[model samples]
Target: MDKATVVRKVILFSALAATVYVSIGTSDEAPVQVKIPTSETIQRPAVSVPGTMQVAEELGAESDGSDPFEPRNWVPAPPPPEPVKEVVAPPPIAPLTIPEGPPALPFQFMGRLKDGTDEVVYLGRGDQPVVARAGEVLESTYKVISITPTQIEFEHLPTKQRQVLSMQSN
Candidate 1:
């Protein structure tokens, strides 16, 4: 509708018409030919470079006389570094000493009796009644060390470990 829009449409139509005319136009001349040489037609340079021959000779001299393509001539890759052996120290040895002690006294303190010079103590094991006195070994396993009103002390004969039993009423 505007003058600028009309002018732009006319220019676009002219460009499209020119492109179509050129695409459909008949040409009198033939298409130009381009030649790409094959491997047999390719030519190498006539002149040899100065340092190339010396470089080739040096490369040949440094070889170990083994074929480059031979699998047997290739060096094995150093056995993969021997897998980096980790030295693990053994666990610390515990000190060797006596580890066993006397087992728990199976007696329950029943009561005590003041038997003139030596005080006697009554101990019960399970349902059996046992009587003990000071310095007397009972059952060949325990020695009655001392007896008190509230507690009694006994020594295990095997280990010489002293243990006390309290005389408490339940």
Candidate 2:
């Protein structure tokens, strides 16, 4: 009746047509149909049942001894129990916070002591030589976040990458 229904019918007919085309294209011989006769000994003649037959069956088939309807012979069904629903509790909520930093100093500098993020503590890189070894204790201006006898580590706040700057200490 509608355009959409017509389009759907067209698509269905196209698919069937494609299938038939493929089948016909691949066939080599012509198809034929043959009807065979059946061999039955006693052919029971059809008889019209009385209008009251159904009523008689429902009334009482067992009392008459002859059961025109199927004898129930049905076993008793098992008792069914009510379904139980599970009660799920909601999950607990908590605040997100980074763990405290370690107590160890970032470098072995020894000029001034300061706190960082209430976790990291920094020592001043005061008058220390531009070059300071890992075990070497030196004074610093506290301006340098990272410096070493061999190199300095430069870390951008957002990028979070530490770039190594070689020390060209004179």
Candidate 3:
């Protein structure tokens, strides 16, 4: 064999011999003794047999007429109550309609005068005196429809709604 292999083998055998020699030299002392317990010799905790027997008797009294071990005598639980459905009201079918009309007249009647064949009415707008004849449009929003001695008729230019102004004598 090679020199290195012989050296390795010699080292391995010397380590094994040393281990065996140490194990044998250490056996000169007495062996340690350990006691193992058995189930028969072990002490068991005490229980109250009267209380357990009384509980078992009460359970037996509360049992139903069906036998627990018999599968045919078992009763299936009733199905859970159906979930409550929320009622929701529908939206309105048609929207509400708002009445359409013109605003109130802002003029006050003062008096009337004869303007040749056509008559002219005097009206008061705040502190201003407005003279208007039949078929004339005043303030670009109101058109004079007719003029009379006691009352005057006017039409709202934008909404085409008729309005009247009465004469007030003091």
Best by lDDT: 3
Q: Give me the overall lDDT of model 3.
A: 0.82
State TM-scores per candidate: 0.40, 0.23, 0.40
Candidate 2: stretches off by over 4 Å: 1-60, 63-81, 99-147, 156-170
Computed on alpha carbons, the lDDT of every model, listed in order, comes to 0.81, 0.50, 0.82
Query: Residue-wise lDDT of candidate 3 within 53-169, one digit each (tens)?
Result: 454555565445444455563678779999999989998689788668778899998888885797878889999999998899999999999877777899999899999988766
Model 1 lDDT tens row, 12-107: 999999998777676566766899999999976555564544544555655555544446636665655566789999999999886698898999
In angstroms, how far off is 64's CA in candidate 1?
Answer: 79
- Could you give the C-alpha RMSD of every candidate to the true structure, in order shown? 14.4, 22.7, 17.7
Q: What lDDT does candidate 2 reach at residue 59?
A: 51
- Residue-level lDDT for 31 in candidate 1: 62
Pairs of residues clashing in candidate 2? 125-140, 125-141, 125-142, 126-139, 126-140, 126-141, 132-149
| Winner on TM-score (2 vs 3) | 3
